[model samples]
Target: MNARKVLLAEFLGTLLLLAIVVGSGIMGERLANGNAAIALLANAAATAGGLYVLIVLFGPISGAHFNPAVTLAMKLRGEALPASLAAMVCVQVAGAVLGVLLAHAMFDIALWQPGDHVRTGVAQWLSEGVATFGLLLTIVLGIRFRERAVPALVASYIFAAYWFTASTSFANPAVTLARSLTQTFAGIRPIDAPAFIAAQLVGAALAVLAARALLPAHSSVRR
Candidate 1:
């Protein structure tokens, strides 16, 4: 039953995240008057806001792991049960797909339009790695030092990464895959997902190692 609750939270939270990302991008594009920068700014702002709410709302239930990279990191850190990891990833991916479909429906677009957005390249891949690394690092340390600040810090990081990173910080594997199914401003080409996912996994692995060194599990001391 506990595992079930965790999975449910992961599913619902991931779904909401995708909806916010894709929906905001669509809305921003339509309202930006051909200014791509303006649209991206709007998209990033909404995503960050939605992300903060989702994390705060779901943190108690499942640690609010809306990203596969985060789930993997938690599992490695022993924060999530090993047996539950597979189920968590499965539900997150499923929820992400559903969120894309829902967003498309809401915007009156095709349900599964494969994106043609070219988002692959060395710089973008490297950006994804750095972005994911920062995210996992934040999660590990935030939970250790100031848990309440996590939502704000994470949202702020992602909002900033949208502009700082070449890939706009699609740091989550489930998110990357789902975004490939939409041709909206937030989408990535299906062909480019492998590189992005690979980069994210590598980044997350590195983060787990770094967090272990920087904020070891035994380092927490109550004040």
Candidate 2:
């Protein structure tokens, strides 16, 4: 029952997260009159706001991990049970895909179209690494010092990261994969997902190690 609860929470949280991302991107693009900056602003703001609400709603049930990278970090940090990590990632990915489909359906777009958006190069990969690193770092520190503020902290960081990062900070592997299925403003070329996922893994691992070394030994937070 407990595992079921975790899975349900994760699935729902991830679904909502991706829906916000893709839906807002489409809406923003349609409304922005070809202004990339304005479209991005709407997308980022909606994502951040929706993410915060979802986390608050689901944190008690599944720790509100809508990202596979975040789940991996928790697993490595010994916060998440090894037996549960695989299930969590699976559900998150599935939920993400479903979310994209939902968004497309709402916007009357074709489902499962591959994205053509070309997000690549060394700089973009490096930005993904940095973005994931910061995200995990914030989670770890927030859990340890200010558990109550984690939702807001994470949302705010992501909102800023969208503007600062070259690739707009798709810090979650599941999100990167799902977004590849869409041809919207939030989409990334399918070919680019692998590198982004790789960067996110590296970043998550680094954040786990850093947190282990820096945080107090007896901290209450698991990850």
Candidate 3:
């Protein structure tokens, strides 16, 4: 694949992903009439649906890895070159920021504001670790056994993770960073992002280790 095309695909995919996440959260909060559960449900549903479509659309181009953790996993697995990994991570972050700004524009909010939503503590960090672990595991296993279902698997997992995790499962590092720019329903405080990102990276690494043990490179499972 051409490097430029790969980068473009990643950029667009990540941009749209953040847009869906932040936009839906904003919309959901506004329309839910102060019902946090309903707002969350709407946010999760929109994010899941958008994620599925983005993956299906961009998977062929760049594997639709909108998340830096997913890109890191691919790099470690030798599925992605180091150069591409670096470029993808950079663009994914840039795109995520742009996506957040886009969402703010749509909602007529301040384009550059620090998020004040205070999310922290050991439980939240653990939840982030677990959420990211499950995400990477799902991607790796889904690709090994059911390549065509990767998008659906990821989307469904995220939707469920949103509800199950205390931090709302901000499994992507790019997303965690971008979300700190907003103060909406999906935003996380800037101070809280680093721990979440560290936990996510640890989780991703552990998932890769587990996947390697469960599914060796030489073992070929019938697809």
What TM-score does model 3 achieve against the real structure?
Answer: 0.97
Error of 2 at 73 (Å): 0.7
Off by over 4 Å in 2: 220-223
lDDT of 2 by residue, 109-194 (tens): 99889999999999999999999999999998998988999999999999999999999989999999999999999999999899
Candidate 1 lDDT by residue in tens digits, 1-223: 3888888989999999999999999999999989999999999999999999999998888888888899888877777353377888999999999999999999998997998899988999999999999999987788788778999989999999999999999999999999999999999999999999999999999999998888755855422
Worst 10 contiguous positions by lDDT, candidate 3: 77-86
lDDT of 3 by residue, 1-223 (tens): 8889889998999999999999999999999999999999999999999999999999998888899999999888878553467899999999999999999999999999989999999999999999999999999999988889999999999999999999999999999999999999999999999999999999999999999999977656536
Residue pairs with clashing backbones, model 3? none
Residue 48 CA displacement from its true place in model 2, Å: 0.3
What's model 2's overall lDDT? 0.93
How much is the lDDT of residue 220 in candidate 3?
A: 60
TM-score of each: 0.96, 0.96, 0.97
Cα lDDT, model 1, residue 1: 33
The order by descending lDDT is 3, 2, 1
- The models' CA-based lDDT, in order, is 0.92, 0.93, 0.94
Candidate 2 worst ten-residue window by lDDT:
74-83
